[model samples]
Target: MAAAQNTPGQHRGMDWCGFAGFRASKAPMQAYAAELGATMQLQVQMPRRQPAPADIVEEYTYTRHFVAIDDPVRLLEILPGLPADKNHTYEIILKDKPCKLCVDFDGTDGLPACFASKQDFTSRVQDVLTDIFLTEFGVQLPAESFVWVFTDYPVKFRAHLVEHHIMPDGRILCLPQHNPTHATRRRQALLQQAGAGHA
Candidate 1:
């Protein structure tokens, strides 16, 4: 059952709709690293306000190479699944030597899983991205670094910041604006497809 309702902004932990959040500074990641030793790096940039709000907010990119794993498809199937409201997009390149996976995620239909505002979320995500690249790929993120990764063919995560300007009327517009008709059709299609498949 969908549990009892609570605050609108408060997400239920088990619902699978929240964010991965700051994985470091906690156990598991910390615990795993204790045994793994210094394999990664994490860096951050101080926030700077623009004379006028700009579309470009945050960006990250990383690349690494791994021993030709026996099966790359299996490796990809295991990465955490993205929420329906959100979508993760990337390219998997397999060449003669090693294999590489490049992936990134945008804010999607809702606000980021962490931070109070989009700006805060952008900064935090950038920090996490740098940390992952440093630790996973053994690379360092430089300020104005532009790019945080450079490795053989393995796995890479990258992101960019795009924005929608707020009108002088004090209205902010974002993607995935609610459309009741669209929602209803999507739900009905799901039901019909389920029924047809079952038959």
Candidate 2:
């Protein structure tokens, strides 16, 4: 079940940037990365967070490409030297090319899974935050655990997350919000349909 820890004075009413927290787990990284070496390729895969009971997915996420620990003895040595509290991790930018990432938010209701760029690397953070929210609370939250919602509507052509689809986990997944003009037009069309149906 997902759990949350709130930070003080961080809430901005119903729709602004809010901070919802959850219980973090011990890092299973060292054991996970042990199958690495110069000759033997480490087939890396990480578990994706499930927002609902039925949606269990896995993403092949890695920060760095290759950890050049060819010697068996060296692998045992430096692993212990890494710091703790590494629940949140990043992929290595390898010498061959930048590491490709595939991220899923909540794993239940997701924005499409695609390769991310260096500029948009931070966006995957939403995936991490959503994972914690869903896994701990047993609820699929909006792509929000630590997110900055706009104070006003149509912030950079994107509207608010007020009315949206509620997932099985009680999370709201709103359609991509755009400019006020388009949203207003869509709302007008919906209202017209409602009126026609009543008549």
Off by over 4 Å in 1: 1-108, 146-199
Q: List where candidate 2 sits over 4 angstroms from the true fold.
A: 1-37, 40-66, 87-199
Q: After superposition, how far is residue 114 of candidate 1 from its true place, in Å?
A: 3.1
What TM-scores do the predictions have? Answer: 0.22, 0.17
Residue-level lDDT of model 1, residues 61-84, one tens digit each, is 111111112244633542344333
Best by TM-score: 1
Model 2 scores worst on lDDT over the 10 consecutive residues at: 151-160
Candidate number of the best lDDT: 1
